[model samples]
Target: MTHPLTSLSGKKGLIVGIANRHSIAYGCARVLKAQGAELAVTYLNAKAEPFVRPLADELDASLVLPLDVEKPGELETVFDAIREQWGRLDFVVHSIAYCPLEDLHGRVVDCSLEGFQQAMRVSCYSLIEMARLAEPLMKDGGTLVAMSYYGAEKVVENYNIMGPVKAALESTVRYLAHELGSQGIRVHAVSPGPLKTRAASGIAHFDALIDAAIERAPQNRLVDIDEVGATCAFLVSDAARALTGDTLYVDAGFHIMG
Candidate 1:
């Protein structure tokens, strides 16, 4: 047996937003699965299945699901499947975020109404939706985590509308923590330094961001998904019972720089 502070053996968790091998969600899923947690993992759509299924099979995930949170009835279907299979949820890792290409490239002020609304709904509101749906399933109390970026706090060029969107997501984490605390539920925002993930490809000049993170971070290096996953594993473990509504930076001290 492993250390209880980090052992998730026999626990159950849902992992969303794994687009491919390089995804941060994939990293989190890998670590959780390694710790013996049974996982319920999602792919964005049919085109994504080939990539995700292999990983799920590798992890021995209990359920490999199609979870387009934007699609009608889709989110409910996933939760329904989870209820039918495990009947309880011990943790969740939410790493999905979306923004239209134009809005992502444009100034925040120029973001279209539709794009802004869609971004908020998918990136921020989805976390709230998951927390509400998981509350009852977490009868013994559990942990909920979502991915965030430094963009949520400070101005990061080319981050554009996502800056505000992530800000909203971080704030939602706090409110959910407060509302769910009595039940022993914990909520957190894990902000990682920029990496070369498929999702990061959406941002213009992301290479620059990656380079900047390394150059400025005290460690003089970038963080990998495994590093981020290690922290996620800890946060969901019983050892982190006293922590809630906080943002955990797995950014290699990048946030400490000017």
Candidate 2:
């Protein structure tokens, strides 16, 4: 069976925040490459090299650079590296997010100011940072996608500061889409149901949370990382040209439940 994504034979992509094969970003990278999109990836530090190196080699990525969201100059360095290697980019996937573990396992109202600031900075502000740097490289226009979750729209216990971070991310998508539309660039969010990523495991009771999601969602199962990846590939592809400034839920219909 043929995949429903647009042909990406000559396009290039930059995907940030891939830590391992189980990561949603890695899923996106895999599908995008399978569909003919040339890829570039980013790791948070040298420690991640052992994990990301094989995947980068597997995809025949144009480049793989270090990019810690909190690290000064990392984003600029990666963008410069991409520019040097590819000159132009056709798509970028912002798969990065963070929050203090203490804040995530407790009440939202109890979250510390520092925790909130850090969460927003890493999860929400990073997209803006990427957009500013990538816009120039997308001379012919391109797609920008950010990862989101159901917690941003509904109350999910143990999701705390990260929920608001996703809310800000979703809102930023609209603002960016509006600003970048004239240049023919698209911006959107892909919200997936709960899944156990290395980051997700940090949240207290994450296993029970996944069980609850599988029980309540229409599919009666947690969404696979690859499913999220495939959706991302479609969103960034040409077939999804009519879509922008929207949050497309790939959450097994969990977001729609009461």
Candidate 3:
């Protein structure tokens, strides 16, 4: 089927949290590039520099910067760079979330207060920060998209702290959508089923979890990153203009059955 949205030929987008080829954010970047949007990218630190620099080069991104969301100044720096370079941004993709592996594997009741706060900071607060920073630069109005997981809705095994974080992230999507709607900006989240990613693999029993999703899901298989990317493109495009304050699932039809 022909894609309903206009090609993002002249659009400039900021993509955060691409770790490697396996990351969903990377998939989003690839598709967005193919769709002709100019992009800017960021990685967490020097450790990921070697991995992401080549990919940013491949996309011919306008800027590649280091960001540690926990760093109070980094968010402003990144957005300032975007303002300086692009002057205005058409869209942003937020694929960042983090929680201690131990905290995610343990019971929620046992989660450390520090761990909970850290999770909320990285996984939830970053979106709020991004929205606040991006709202001004989207002078003509734009889209902000984030990646979430089914764990936010149904408690999957060992997805402890992140479940709550994703839940809050989803809520942020709606609240931001309402607040930004006046400005014509759309805010939304994409919830995908379990897949093998560096981050997802941190969970205990991750393979069994993927296999379980495959077995029980209506599609009888795991979701793919490119599929998620395509859906993201739709969300950021004009065809989805009426959609906002929503969490759209790109999970291989897996989320509906069980």
Q: Give me the candidate number with maximum lDDT.
A: 1
RMSD of 3: 1.3
Candidate lDDT values, in order: 0.94, 0.89, 0.89
Q: Residue by residue across 188-207, what tens digits does model 2's lDDT show?
A: 99998887899899888888
Cα deviation at 131, candidate 2, in Å, is 0.4
Write candidate 1's Cα lDDT for 8-35 as tens digits.
Answer: 9889999999988899999999988888
Report the C-alpha lDDT of model 3 over 1-108, residue by residue, as the tens digit. 335475778889999989998899998999888887899999999999999999999989999999899988998999999999889998999999888877888999
Give candidate 2's TM-score: 0.96
Lowest lDDT sum, 10 consecutive residues, model 2, at 1-10
TM-score of candidate 1 against the unseen true structure: 0.99
Clash list (residue pairs), candidate 1: none
lDDT of 1: 0.94
Candidate 2 displacement at residue 229 in angstroms:
1.2
Better of 1 and 3 by lDDT: 1
